[model samples]
Target: MSKFMVLVKQLYKQKVSAKSFILTTLLYLVVLAGIMYWSEIRDLIFSGDADTIAVVNETNFDVSEVLQNTDDYEYEYVTAGEVAEKLKDGDYYAAFTLTDADGKLAAKIESYDPLPLNDQQSFQGMLSQAGQIYAMSQLDLSPEQQQLLLSSEPIITLNSINEAAADGKSADEKMAGVWISYAIGIIIYIFVATYLSIITTDVASEKGSRALEMLLVSVKPEIHFRSKIVGVFLVALTQFIILFGGLLLLLRFSDGGNKWSIVTNLLDSMSIGYFLYVMGFLFLTIFMYLIIGALFGSLVSKVEEAGQVMMPAMMLTLVGFYVMLTGMGNPDTMLIKVFSYIPFTSGMVMPMRLGATDISAIEPIISFGLLLGTVLALYFLSLSFYKRSVLTYSSGGIIEKMKTVFKVTT
Candidate 1:
């Protein structure tokens, strides 16, 4: 047991200290942080010099005053003559004219280049609101009438007969749930495939060389095998810790401007318990795949064959990923419910159901128990014939050699 611990520690340090490992971890951290704070980064890169929008108000009221300035456009009230001169000299991004046309308010925009779709949409929405506000002010209605007209809610109320559909999850919340499920499934699928490749290569390279045999003389092959798996798992965990740690620090320090807060609020809707359970399940799922990768590596006689043996694991995870997509459409399906208890497929499917559905509270626990049991079963099974897998060097396909190993061990 003490030797196992020592071996595990050595393996961890050796891999973690590798230049490639450190570079990869740092690169992942930088990329994730960049994605999370993309808006801020965009502002830093593109702000400080906003294009001026020369406003020509030929109407009685001020249109520019009613509209808010954005980082992309700064409003500058100018004369009709000044609008032409400023635009000619490239001092203005565009000219916005507000005038009375056909006895009603009208607006027009002229620019050197065609405006972007987003900018056009923004201008139209805000100008429409400004027109409404001006028209409202000109009316000789009572204060109560104005208040009634300004009420944000629809005049016709919508009440669902089904209470569960209206369980405080807004349309936005449900949308967020769908996207979150997608991210979870993709993360599991990609991470499992990526780290599985890493583990197989690590094992196959050593097993293909004389070093594995010398190491087996000091330690039992099974213990050595598990130590390597655990080590690789730790490497994966370290990368996640750095990535999530940076996220936590950002959440702690940054004000999370308007766009970022919307995303954070969507995440905040879930209970702490759900996050904890999903994280544990994700860890178990990855570790289980890593174990399988190690086994595949032990079976391969050549170091280069490590990547070739991942077809089975990839196909199984792909099936689970598809189930997750199906769950996003309808979580109450029998397909999702049944697969949630299946160890191989549950990693992605169960998380989708938990976040998207309000199923019986005990169901997740039961599913988790099944998954935990499967992981332990696989671990012990791997320990039994791992020595045979590493020692035998017969040349064949992964399954053929694996069958020979089990055949001899049994």
Candidate 2:
């Protein structure tokens, strides 16, 4: 037990202190910070008053009110006669001449250095909005009536047969399920991508260095394999806790959290049953992939073969992730239903089933059973060849190496 723990600790320390791990963790942190402060970052890039815009309104109506200074651009109301002077004097970045054409509002910028697409879009949108307000106000209506006229967006009401709408929690559950399913799927995909290399390198590189043979004399194969797996698992979990916990903390306490709070929405939507099922599927998926990675790692007789053997694992991740995305959008379709039973895809699909759809308990039970069975099967299969595969060296592709391992095990 002492030896086993020492091995685990050694592996953990090595991986956690490695340069790759540190860099990836830092990258995740930068991404998390960006997502949390996206609005502020966007403001810094696209916001702030840059240059003064000259606006000459030729219409009798007061179109100058909505043309006031904004964060994107500053507007200075000037007469049409001074447009040339302002352009030549470099007093304005851009000049707009607003005119009522055929009783409709039309504005055009002076032929000069054209603004960027975003600026042009914003300029046209403001003019369009100003026209809307002017057209609406001309009616003989009160302020309340005009406000109602401007608010034309529809609010959809629920009419589902489930108790989803009874406590006003259905919408929360529905939206949160979709959002978290994507989150869970993406989290699984990225961790697998990042740490699968760790798993492969730990086994393959050790095999290449001829260190495993000596190490096995002191520690049993099962203990060594299990320790390495556990060590990498802990490292992955540590990285996740840091990244996810930091994101949640920021999103909960930051100024943006008050308005754009995924943490709050996730809490409101999470039920005991859904939470348990999500965790079950999430663990099963990540665990299954970890073992597969170890299996692939063990297949590589040399460290150089590790990169060549990652294709199979990555292909599975891609297929599962894309299918999960499709399933979340339309959960009850036959495509999703088929993938829901697939062990690789179900971890992503089944959660969407339970959380997004109104499925009964029986479906998930059977789906989870199949997935658990697959994990168990993979565990034994990977364990059977692990000891031999590490020692077996060959001079062919990965398929040939696999065949050699299979023959030796049989």
lDDT of 2 by residue, 236-328 (tens): 899989997887777776674583465765766678877788788877887888788787887877888888887788888788888888976
Off by over 4 Å in 2: 38-51, 63-68, 80-97, 101-103, 107-127, 152-155, 161-173, 256-262, 325-337, 352-361
Tens digits of per-residue lDDT, candidate 1, 358-402, equal 665688899999989989999888767677788878677777888
lDDT of 2: 0.80
At residue 192, give the lDDT of candidate 1: 89
Minimum summed lDDT over a 10-residue window in model 2 is located at 163-172
TM-score, candidate 1, is 0.76
All candidates: TM-score: 0.76, 0.84
Residue pairs clashing, model 2: none
Instruction: Give each model's whole-structure lDDT.
Output: 0.80, 0.80
